[model samples]
Target: MTIYRELVIHLKEETMKDIELLVIYQNAKTLLFHDSKQTNTIEDFVTGCIHHYIDRVKHQIDLSGINDLGKPYRLQNHLKEYIDKKGISQAMLAERTGIGASNLSLIMKNKNQPSLDYFFRIWIALECPPLDKILYRVEE
Candidate 1:
């Protein structure tokens, strides 16, 4: 059976960019199934999501002040929780992701915000393809 899920990824300046690339699709087997295209890369997945929105434009979404070019929404950091549940140590994660334990710590504490490049690195290293509680949209 197919289920409809809404994902709002709000990457703020105070959040880790790498966390955005996590292809966490804890829903259906057809992850990001925009036209049944498998998103081989983060760009593809993102583009698929955009295309999905465009395809469903007639669904009537609340685009209040969308043309105002508003700032991005605040993101809820759940990487630490994800890591804890995975039973992976920060040192091990740093080694696997090459992101440095200190930087990882800052991200967990919501201190440092890295660039977009790190997203792919983290996603690739962690090999995680599920999001669910790993991230969510926090409309501020």
Candidate 2:
């Protein structure tokens, strides 16, 4: 089998057990796997899988809705807070990250989901320590 097929199989065996993965896989498979005429490269499959995972995670979070008591945190809010605390403007952040100010605003407003590259750029611009703290948290 090709590397792409192998990766799909591996993900199915190892990661599909999780509900999140299952949803992601189903959505990704529907959207990406249908195009058999396209190149069946490992990179293609991996990219699709990664996108699926992101979509699934976003969907799950959206289903939960915004917490009124501020129990659950969001990346947009975290970024805004960081910007406020650091007294940095969006234009400054955009310059530091090499992203357009409008793009940064869209991301901050949660109107667009940034790719990993953009995320890293923002992270580095913020100089946030304990990166995991910014990315995730334990439910109380």
Best by lDDT: 2
Error of 1 at 28 (Å): 25
lDDT of 1 by residue, 1-140 (tens): 99868777766754434534454452224554544645355555666778877766655434433334465655545677777877878788788888877888887665655456665666565675344435444456
Query: If scored against the real structure, what TM-score would every candidate get?
Result: 0.45, 0.40
lDDT of candidate 2 over 50-110, digit per residue (tens): 8988966665543232444467644433576668777999989989999998888987776
After best superposition, candidate 2 residue 83: deviation in angstroms? 0.9
Weakest ten-residue segment in model 2 by summed lDDT: 129-138
Global CA lDDT computed for model 1:
0.61
Q: What count of clashes does model 2 give?
A: 0
Each candidate's number of clashing pairs is 4, 0
Model 1 segments more than 4 A misplaced: 1-72
